[model samples]
Target: MASYWRTPKPGRKIPFIKKSPVENPIMEPSIPTHFRCPISLDLMKDPVTVSTGITYDRHSIETWFEVGNQTCPVTNNVLKSEELIPNHSLRRMIQDWCVANRSLGIERIPTPRIPVTPIQVSELLSEIASASRRGDRARCRELVAKIKALGRESERNWRCIVSGGAGRVLSASFSELAAGSFDNSTSGVLEEILSALAACFPLDEEAHWHIGSPESLNSLVLILNCGDLAGRLNAVLMLKELVSSLDADRINVVADTDGLIEALVKLIEKPISPQTTKASLVTTFYLASSSEMTAVKFVEMGLVSLLLEILVDSDKSMCEKALAVLDGVLESKKGRETASDHSLAVPVLVKKMFRVSDMATGFAVSALWKLCKNYEQERGEGCLVEALQVGAFQKLLLLLQVGCTGTTKEKASELLKLLNGMRGRGECIETVDFKALKRPF
Candidate 1:
C-alpha cells in the first residue's frame, strides 16, 4: 500500500498548495425596533406617546413643539393636542434591554423623572398669591419654597415655571414688598423673593421693568449691605441683570442710590466668594459705563484699590472685567488720579499687558495710555519716567511684537512712539535698557 503521506526528499523541490483566506463575519448587536425614537432614530430614555399615537423621546417631542412643529413627524397629520403621555411600558422595555446588554457596554437608564406640569405651577402661584394677600409670612414662605423647589428640580421645570408666569409674579411680589415699609423682621421674605428671582434667571423684560424701579433697586442694595452670603449673592446677581438691561436714565438712578456704590465696594473688599466678587465687578462696570457721573461715583467710592487687589489675585476672566471697570473709571480725571496713587497701579498695568488675554491687554494698555496722555503734558517727565520705571516700554514692545487686536496694536504703537520720543528727547530722566526689556522665550 502506498503511504498516504510522503516525506519530501531532502533538498528536492516540493509541490505546495495555496489556500484562500477565510474571514470571520462581524456581528453587530441588533436593536429592538420599538426602542428607537422615530424623530431622533436613537434609543429612547424617556418615551412619550403624542396625540397622533406616535412615540418619541420626551426631549425630542418637546423640541418639536418648541420649533413650532404642530404635526406628527411620522404621519404629517395635524396634532389635535400637544399633550405628551408618558409611554411607561416602552420605557420599561428599553430599560430592561439596557440591563440585558450590560456586558456589551450598554448602561442601564435611570428611572425617568417627572417634570413639573403647567397646572401644578399655576396652583403654586395661586397659593402664593393667596398667602401674600393675607400677609401670612409663614404660609408665603412655604409656598415660595415650593416654587423654588420646582425651579431647582430641573431645567424643564424652570421653563414651566417661567412659562406659567411665576417669574412675573415673583418680580411683582418683590416690587410690592420693596415698596412697602420693610424692617429687619421681613428680611426673610426678601431673601426668599431674591432667591426665587435668581433661580428664575434671565427674567423677562416685563420682570425687568418691575426690578428696575427705584424702590426695587434700593431694596436690592439694602440686601447687599445686610443680607447673608446667599441672599447677598442673589441680590447682587439680580442687580447685575437689572442694571445691565436698564436704560441710561435708570442706570443713573441706580448710580445715585445712597450706599449703592459703597455696598458693591464692600462686597469686593470682603468677598464671600469669587462669584460674588465677579458679580460686584460686573455691576460696577455696568454702572460706570452708563455715564460720566456714574464713573465718577465709582472713583469716589474708592474702587481703584479694591480693583487693583482683585486684578492681582483673580483669574483671567476676573482680570478682564476688573480692567474694563478700571478703564471706565480712568475716563475721569479724578479716576486717573485715584489709580495713579495706588502703589501697584503702574506696575500692575504693565505686567498685565501680555500676561492676560488680548481684551485685557487692550484695557491695560488703554488705561496706561490714558494716564500717560492725561498727565504727560501737565506732570511732564514725571509720568513718563514712572511708566519707564515700571517696564511699560518693554511690555508695549512685547505687545506689538506678539500682535494683538488691530485697535490694540494701533494703541500700543502710538504709546510706544510717544514713550520712545520722550526718551530720545531726554525728557525721561530715568534710563531704560531697551534690549533688556525684550522678554526671553
Candidate 2:
C-alpha cells in the first residue's frame, strides 16, 4: 500500500499523496470547508503548484498576484505568477460569485489549493498569444478551452493579457474576431473577445491626460473600421476621455478626418432618413469636436461645399444642425478667416436667404448675420450693403412679411440692426418700411 506519508519529493507537497488507495485503503479525511477556494470557496479546480512546494486554489492565487500578494498563502514564500489573457466568462463568473457572496454577508473566503503555478498560466497564455501572432484561430480557441477549464482561477490573468500593454496579443486576437471573418457559429466566442478587450483596455486617466501611445491610436482605428457602431461609439467615447494626440506621421490625421467627413456626407447626401441622418449628424458633431486637425481636414476635403448643400436641403433639422456647426466655426478665429474668403460659401448663404421654408430662411439669415459680422470689422459697411444688394434686404422683407411672424421677428430685428449700420454708409436702399419691419404683425 502507498503509505499516507510515504515521504514525497523534497519540495513537492502533494495533498493526495498520503491518502486512500483502491482496495481497503483508509477513507480519505474530508478537508475542512476552509480549505476550499477563497474566491469561489468551492472545491478548488486544477490546483497549481507554487514555488514553496505548496498548493492553493487557482482563482485565489490569481487574486493575490493581482494586488501584489503573490506569496504562497500557506508557506509565505514568494511565488512567481504568469501574465493572464482575459477570459470574459470566467471573469463574469468570479464577479457573479463575489456579488452573490457579498449579498449573503460573507466577509472573506478562504482558499484551499495554492493558485496554479504562474509558470503554468504563463505557458497557457503564451500558447494563445503565439496562435494569435500566427493568425491561427483554431489554435487560439483550443488554448481558450484549456484556460477556461481552470475555471475562476484564470480570470485575473486572462484580463491582464487581454488589456495589458500597448501591444497585447489577446487584444489582437479580439480585433481579428471583430473583423467578421470568424464564423457566426462562434459569436458567443466573439462576445467573450469583446468583453476581454474591454476589461483589458480600460481608460487610464493619468496616462491618457499626459499623451497617448501610438498603440492607442491603433486600437481606435481598428474599432472605427469595424461595422459595429456600438463598438465604434465606445471607442470614440474612450478617445474623448483620453483626449490622446494622434501620431500625425503614421496615422495621417488628415486622411482619417477626410474619411470620417466622407462617411458623414454620404449619410446626408440623399433624402435623409431619420435614424441614419441623426446618427450621421451626431457622428459629424463628434468628428468636428474631436481634434483641431479634424475641422482643418474637413475644409481641405471640401466639406464646406457639402455643408452648403445641407444648408439648402429640405430637412430643417439637418440644415439647423449643419448651420449650428457652421456658426461654431464662424465664432472661431479660423472660421472667421475661412468665411472671410466668401467666394463660394457666401453666395450659398445669399441664395438660402430667399428659401421658402421658415427654418431654412432662419438658418440662412443667421449664417449671413455671422458672416456679415465676421467681415464687418474687415470689409467695412460697403461689403454689408453689397450683401444686401445681393437680395439681403429683400429676403429680410420676405421673412418679415411671412417668415418673420414668430421666431423670425427677433432675428429680423437683429438683421435690421446689422443692416441698419450699412444704411447710411452703403448706397442705402430703404426698401421695406422700417416701421413695418419693427411692428409685430
Candidate 3:
C-alpha cells in the first residue's frame, strides 16, 4: 500500500495552505407585527383608519369600496361610510422603524401628499368664472392650469373637482368661448379647459346632460374641428362619455350637430393614437346605432372606407369594433352602395370571417350575408363570381365545418346555398375543390 501511494520527494518544499477567514452572515431584522396591515399582512405604506377603527392600506380600502363591498374586511360589519381617515401616528411609527432598520435594506417612506379638497376646487372654479366674466384670459388660464394639476394628482381629487361643479363651470366657459368672437390669445385657455373636462372622473348623469346641451355640444364639435391635436383628443374623449350617458333624444341631437360626423371621420382618417381612434369609433358606433337616419348620415360621411382601412391594420379587438360599426352602417341603402363600391370591401369582409374572433366572424358573416342577399342579383352574377374568386366560398364552407357562433353557422350555411344556386353554368364553380374546404389550422 505504501509503495502504491507515492509520497513527495525528500528535497521538495511543502505547499503552504492558507485558510480563508470565516464570513459572518448578515441577518435581516424582523418586521413588527403592528406595522403590518390586517388585510394584506404587509407593511402599510399609506395606512388609513376606516369607520370600523381598523387600519388598512388606503388602496386596499378604496378597492374594497370600488368593488361594491360595503362591509369592513376585519370585522365584516356594515360600514357606515367609505370615509378613510389618515393614520398619521401609525405612519410615523412605521417610518421610524424603517429608519432604525436601514441596515436591513428597508426604504424610508416619503410623506404622503394630501389630496385637494372640494372647497379648494370650488374656489378655483369661482376664480375661473370670474376671470372668464372679466375677459381676463391670462387669469383664467392660470386658474385652469391649477385645476388641471389638482385633477391630475389623484382620482380622489378628480371626484372632488367634479363634485364641486367643475363640469358645469367648464361647459359654460366653453359655450361662452364658442358664442363669442374668436380670439387667438384665448384659444390656449379653451384647450386647457377641454383637457380639464376630459380629465374629470366619469361624469354623473347631471353632468352628462349639461355637456350634451345644445351650447356645450356645438362648442365640442367646434373644438373637434379646429382645436390642436391635444384639444381634439380630449374633445373626442368627452364626446364619447357624453354620448354614452345621453338618452335617445340627446343622441339625435349629437347626430344632427354640424361637422360632428365629419370631424370624427377626419379623426379616423388621421389618427393621433390608437386610443383616440378607438374612442372615435366607439362614439360613432353609439351614435349610428341610435337610429336608422343616424346610420345613414354616418354612411354619407364616407365612413366605410375608413372602417375598411382600420380592419386592414387593426388587431383582434379593434377588428371586432370595426366589424360592429360596419354592421350598423350596412343597415341603410347608402351604406351598402358605398361598401360595394369599394373594390377591397367584399374581399376584406370575407377574409375577416375566420381570421379574427368569433364575434368578428359573426359580424363579418352578417355583413356579407346582407350584401349578398341584397345586391347579389343587382350586381348581375359578377359579385358572386368575385366572392368565389377571392376564396369566399371556400372560407364560408370552412366556417361551417369548424366551431363558430350559431348565428355565424346559420349565415354561412345560407350564403353557401345561395352561392351554389347562383353558380349554375359557371366554369369557376366546376373547377372549385370542394374537398379542400378544411380548417386552416
Candidate 4:
C-alpha cells in the first residue's frame, strides 16, 4: 500500500556542519604522532570486526603486526578489546567522506510526463462536436486518421470525448471508427472522429460533453450488443462516464430504465468472455461508484446478489474494486439499511479479513464498523453491546493494530476508543480513556 508517486522534494542540499569546540574534548597530538599507523597516519576506513567480534581495521591491528605497535598506546597495554576503543571515530570519518564525494548538487527528479496538451485536446474535441453537428462522417473519419497517426498507446487513455456516452460518438464517425475506418467528409473530420473515439472508447470528458444527441447512447448500446468483447466493455465504460454528467432521473425518464438496467444486469450475470466479464464488472463498479447512486438503485432493485457474486470472485482486482463499491454502498444512506437486512453480507466480508491477498480488508473493516455505528445510532447502545458480544470489538481492535498505517492511524484509534467505551468500562465522548486495552492479548 505504499505509493511510488512521490512529489518532488524541493530544497537545497545543506552540508553537515562541523561541531563546535564545546562538543568534544581537546585533541591530543602526541598520542596519534607516537601511535599513528606507519602505513598512513590518517583515520581508518571500512573498519570491521574479526572472529572474536572485536573490531579492527588494517591500520589498527594489521599495522600492529607489521610495525610492532601491538601494545595499545592510550591504554598502555595489549589491545585486548577493540570495543574498549571508540568506534564512533571510524563511523564519523566514513560518513564524512560519503557526504563530500557521493552527494549530488540539488537533486532533480524527472517530472512525470503529461499525455496530451489541454489546448490541443480541447480543440480536437470541439472539432468533433462540429463534425457531429454537420453530419460529416467522411470528414470525421479523416480527422480520426490524423489523430490516430499521432500515436495509439500513448493516446489510448488520453483521447477524451465531451459526452460520448450521451451519443456524441455517432456524430463524429463513431460507427465508422468502431469498424476500423475513419472515412468522413469534412477537412478536420479525422480530428473530430478521433475526439469522438476518445470520448466514447476512452470516454474523454471533452468528447462526452460534446455529444450531439440522445442517439449516441442508443448507438453505444447497439455497439455493445453487436461488437466483440473489447468493444462491449469500452461501450459500457463510455456509458459509465457519460452517465456521470447525465441526470439519471432524465435517463430513466427518457430512455427505458428497465431495458438499460436489465442489459447491464444480464451482462453482469453472463458475459461473452471472462475478460469481457471482468471488464463489464469494472464498468458496473464504476457505475456503482459513480455519484448518481446507480449502484444503490441497482441494489434497491435487488441486484445485491449479482454484485456480491462479483465481490466474492477469485479475481483479485475485481474483488477489490467490487468490495470498494460494496463498501461505498453499505455506507450510503439507503445502502446501509439494505446491507443490514442481508444477513450473509457482513459474515462474508468478515471472512475476507483472514486472506492475505485482500489488501482492501482495511476498507472493508472501516465500512463494516461504520455500518455497525449507523445501526447502533438507529437502534440503541444496547445494540452496540450486542455487536461487541458477537466479537466485533475484538476484530476491529486486531484490524487496527495490524492494518492501520499512515492516515488510517487516527481513524483506527478513534474506533478503538469508541468500542472500548461501549464495552461499558469507561466514557468516550466526555473523556478519552483506554487503560483496559493495554492488557496482553
Q: All models: lDDT?
A: 0.80, 0.51, 0.78, 0.50
lDDT ranking, high to low: 1, 3, 2, 4
Q: What value of lDDT does candidate 2 attain over all alpha carbons?
A: 0.51
Model 2 Cα displacement at 266 (Å)?
A: 7.8
Candidate with maximal TM-score: 1
| lDDT tens per residue, model 2, 64-127 | 5545454556666655543333333443444445446664443333333333444676677677
Better of 2 and 3 by TM-score: 3
Best-to-worst ranking by TM-score: 1, 3, 4, 2
Ten-residue region with minimum lDDT total, candidate 2 = 16-25
Per-candidate RMSD, Å: 15.4, 16.1, 16.5, 20.7
Comparing 2 and 4 by lDDT, which wins?
2
How well does each candidate superpose onto the true structure, as a TM-score? Answer: 0.82, 0.38, 0.78, 0.47
Comparison by TM-score, 1 against 4, better one: 1
Question: On residues 296-393, what C-alpha lDDT tens digit does candidate 1 reach at each position?
Answer: 87788778888898788779989999999998898888888787777788878888887688889899988888877766544455556677776678
Model 4 weakest lDDT span, ten residues long: 14-23
Alpha-carbon deviation at 65 in model 1, angstroms: 3.2
What is candidate 3's lDDT per residue for 33-125, written digit by digit as tens? 778776656678889998789998776676566556667887889887767889999999999999988978889888777877666888899
Candidate 4 segments exceeding 4 Å error: 1-171, 175-204, 211-213, 225-228, 240-262, 274-295, 354-359, 377-392, 406-441
Residue 61 Cα positional deviation in candidate 3, in Å, after optimal superposition: 4.2
